[model samples]
Target: MDYGIWNVIELLGALGFFIYGMKVMSEGIQKAAGDNLRSILGTMTSNRYTGVLTGFLITAIVQSSSATTVMTVSFVNAGLISLVESAGVMMGANIGTTITGWLVSLIGFKMKISAYALPLIAVAMPLMFSKKPNLKNWSEFMIGFALLFLGLEALKEAVPEIQKSPELLSFLTQFNDPGILTRLMFVGVGTILTIVVQSSSAAMAVTIVLCAQGLPIEIGTAMILGENIGTTITAELAALVGNVHAKRSAKIHSLFNIIGVTWMVIMLPYVLDLLHYIWPAPETGDPNKFTLALFHTTFNFMNVMLLIWFVPSIVKLATRLVKSKGDEDEEFSLTNINYDAPLTAEVSILSAQKESIKFAEITKLMFTNLKELLNEQKQDTRDKLKAKISKLEVRTDEIEERIADYLVRVSEQQLSIESSVKVRSILSIAHDLERIADIILRMSKDIERGNKQKSIFSEKQNKNIKEIFGLVDLSIEQMITNLNGVYGKVDISGAIETEMAINALKTKMRKQHLKSTEKKEYDVQSGIIYRDLFFAAEKIGDHVINVSEAVRGDFGKDDEDM
Candidate 1:
């Protein structure tokens, strides 16, 4: 048997085509059902069982458990789902991945689906050219589905017949012993193969092909288990640059698979017997393929069943494993934003909306800190509070930039009119929150200047300033309420009234301050600083109104109070 360099290249190319086709198909489904996917994930994972079913359904639809796991991790990172729920989803994803194995065994090897790839593509081409977005997406899905099966066929053809290639079979035979050590060795090989290819489904296809080509079912099963462990590498890599929670989610995935593989390795023979009992292999002609598929499915299903009760324990372990740094260390970064998830424009808008709400909360905290900064009389405490405010301002700047960049990229996608409006609203709200942070920071600086000049406010002046801060805080609270959809409808009436009251208070304070300045109650410098602080505080209220208007999606409407 002469297997040369070109043969290796051809096999690699076929694998690449298969992986690429899977990606195309998965992305097409994501684009077509992105909104529904978001809704399903957001609403369906109420408990572990539901989470498992959600994970299974998503993986089945996307045809890639890796995609489902990655998306689940992203959801956790974004705070859309909890780690415990994600654990169940990850478990179900393990089961969902076996669908690929069953697919290969039932149809891929049993039929000549690739022969129809060209005709499928031809039939889908015109739909691909359709002006309607949904039709175009469906055509893309069909084209990718055809290409995927075509690639699978090519992969089967590219690998030289194991019997004809004595050297290759001989190499594989080295790890074919029934000892535990041999099984572990093959598991390592499987893990490495999956990591190299970056797709467990592709690895599964290769495993099935090898089994069909006379590789022992036991050896193939060992590799299949290895693929389980190997598949986790994707989530781990994704979490490397993510936040603490993202890392925890990824760790849970790794621990879940590794632990499941460990138990299966210990009970390998019994598991195999159970699989045979459930669905006995044919007496002859490559029963290993079916056997391996059943093994993959049973291994994952049993793993989920065994571990479902331990979800809290797993989440606790993961939380302890990945500790959070201090507040300063947890600066804003978009590394965990998960741009790689196949989110449609509509779904992406939901994430952006969540982030915008988070932005509002952060700004509200900044304002609370500003109040403390103003009240602090000790030089050290005031300086510390000022520094904290400065840090928060910098963080707000980063959040705005990242969120804006994310929304801009989302806007570039094929968005519906409503999604486009939501994107713009989120962008506006982010910008407004950022400006509010900036104004609060500026007010902090103005307070510091007043303290430096020994320009103490009179008792009445202090009362006026505190009153304005109170009104501004109320406005912020209302803005957050609107953003949270607590009422399910955008109502700006309260926000408008609050903004008007703030403006009227500022007017009255300005008049009293001007009279006091004329009477020489305080120096001109003191008056100027007083006016600056008042103006800055009033500006924050204006920005809060802007955020509310953005949330209401009525930015063009004139304020009735104005």
Candidate 2:
């Protein structure tokens, strides 16, 4: 049979639709689920076992390992999880991805299931039309699920024509030419195609279709193997713009997949024999779809069982391989970089918490330095403190850019319904953090001016300022440390304490301002200095309140501190 240009075009079109539908569906699911991803992930303990379990559970729900890994990176970037915890999450993601293979196997054989997809689209389209976000998410999920089925049908239709074409069949045969070298070539093609498409499931789907259409099992598995390695590129790409720690996490993903696939390649015959034992060729039956599903599951499960025990060695090897260069501070390393293809819900929450910690630390330090500047009772010391505050302002800008980039990637991770809400929470927290940093910078600048003019506040005013600073400093430290832990159902007491101190300071400062304004005992210069101090103090108080509001999930307007 001479398959013409139109047939190939049809095949391509079907593949396109199938991929598009899957993309749509994954996004919708993520929209539905991503908010909880962050909080769920945030709750993972330092224990690697639990960390891996968290990763596994999230990926299972999202049906995408890339989504899980990406979320892990985001959490890490926000400093929500330690590197070890992130790695465990990545491991769990690998296990979770196996579920898709099972679902595919179960569904692929059903000729009638295609009918369900259309109704799914119909239901989803209406929801998509709704103004509500939840409705839109539901609509998207249906539409996406429908498209996937339709695309599969198209893929099957597109296959038969190509199967009949001698030219196309012959070309494919070159890779299936009963030689190991040819098999490896096919593996390379599969890896490259998946990498290009950025979707292992799509690649897997295509492989299943080919196998269903009577392609050799050996050839299909080779492509699947390639896909495993191909998927790692996403994590690596995520780390490219991220800090060193992120790069490290991505590297581990790549190494883990590559090494596992390599071992599979070396023991190819044994692997095939194992598959054959598990799924013997049906003597009377046509190439059974169940057999295909079995292979996919058994292979992945075996890999997990084999490698899960080797987690320590894998970690050591990956860490040593991606060592940081000298002169590099680990603190600035991309510890929190995420690898999710799109940010999932669980990750968003984790990312938000991480960002809050960083923001809190910066704000606390900013104030502490300001207090020192006020106390400098040494011109040089005051100058150094001033310079540090200016540096901090620049740092806040960097934090925004970095965290925002990570969040955008999180947006891509195909989040879960619950995880999606947490993502929003995280986003809200990040904004509060940036705002807090800005206010702190303003205070820094004010303190700098006072130091330059060799000005001092009245004895009473100085004592009050010192008292306020002491309270804020103590609260911020507790807030940062507690933010990283799980006592939650609620935020750190720091959130409430921050509000209380700020309110007290605002009231006291207002009375002082009234007295100063009425008496006019100070000169014009003194009045100007006094006014700057009052405004700066008020701004700091306002920022702390803004932070508390964010933790409380009150995204209302910033609370003015008197």
Candidate 3:
């Protein structure tokens, strides 16, 4: 009866502090191991099982299932990981998040960790002032860690004692009845609480604390199940603006948890009995905290075990649920790089690198179409091909703009020297790829015009132009390899050789065309078309070499030669 609005504000403030501390700690860890985290996520999630473990480990370390799921969704959006693999990771993330409940129960509630919070801050302050970047990051982690426990302590004090608050207890007792409807109601309460907090870990802590304060364990278990369902909302929110695949991954996460919760509700009594047999609550102290922690862990582990075999089915169901619109739907979109998610410079750079590679591949496809347009003799086919090439040119413009914007955004984040340099290189590569697409589109249009004007190249001239196209194609291939980072070093020698070959071929062909024109073998109109094609091919080769140079970090070096 005596509870005031200020009490509610104080409680909310304490919860905010806890969430902020978790965020700060998660970010510190991400920054410290950003590169390594990228490598692990890139290489380790090759299969469903490994993917699950990767998810588990990342969530465990970050202590935020929401972060893990969001990262997983982003990777799926980026095409860095498959939907099936992402499902495994999501499952593992659910299990990993249970660690927080155990932590809160075993340490935050049991020990006087808050008393040492200031001392930990005192120790971290000196390291924060250190010149070393790693030290600074570690100091930040320690500070967050201290703040987390301090907030936890404050939260414990802020939550009113339910026994002393008869009116509040009576209100809560209405939903504590032992019935299926009551369990569902409690589950809904848990889900809503987690959605409101946007953190299952925080929700779990609140649930555990309430149970410790004499809330029924059965109701708390229902809340735990609801938290499981609610936690997926974070990933769903992240994937809303993402691609179809990302949406499917998020859907799969939701389905997995929801289905698991549904089954657990049916078998609630049996499951709780099993959990209690394995890890019984204390007789004197708050048994509910221990019971809830064990229940949380057991529920996730069981869900993963039950659903791991159904991953393929889940993937198929998700795919069917979220259908792609069509080819236009596949147009270049930045799904993987969520600006709202906690971003590290290393991860942002990786996303940019992948986008750059995709940019190169798109340009290569445009060049292939250009080559097709060059040889097609049928007017209808040529027109259609021209339209396709023109569309691709527009798409390339979009890709370039998106990639550049992504890189610029990434550069705005705190980046290391190396990451900053890489961002610049990627931006340059995107620009060159865009130009290459434009040149190919121009070449296609030239062919269209030549066909319309009845100024076709002679048999011999067409053969020579095809040869130049061949050389340009090889140069594009080399540029793609450079972008893939397969060479491990700045090996621009092949690019340089291809450039020299393109130049020599262009000069020889131009001289031959002039001689042919002088002999009246080709008319002035035909000569102009042939020269335009030759110049365009040579320009494409130049752009390819520029991309290669950017990949090799030699963007401005030897500008005269380029």
Each prediction's Cα RMSD? 4.8, 5.2, 4.0
Clashing pairs in 1: none
* TM-score, model 3 to reference: 0.86
Model 1 C-alpha lDDT per residue in residues 27-53, reported as the tens digit of each score? 577667755765666544598889899
Q: Tens-digit lDDT track for model 3 on 299-381?
A: 89989999999999999998898899886554345424676765455555666776677678778888888888878888788
Q: Model 2: number of clashes?
A: 47
> What's model 3's lDDT at 360?
81
Model 2 RMSD in angstroms: 5.2
**Which candidate leads in TM-score?**
3
Error (Å) of candidate 1 at residue 433 is 3.1
Candidate 2, residue 248: Cα displacement in angstroms equals 1.1
Cα lDDT tens digits for candidate 2, 166-268: 7766776665434677667767978997887787877787778877776766778778878888878877877766666677777777777787777777676
lDDT of each: 0.81, 0.67, 0.81
**Candidate 1 accuracy as lDDT:** 0.81
Which regions of candidate 1 deviate over 4 angstroms?
43-50, 71-82, 163-177, 243-245, 283-286, 319-354, 376-379, 404-429, 453-534, 541-562
Q: Model 1, residue 330: what's the lDDT?
A: 40
Model 3 CA deviation exceeding 4 Å by range: 78-80, 166-177, 330-332, 335-338, 341-346, 407-413, 457-468, 481-527, 545-562
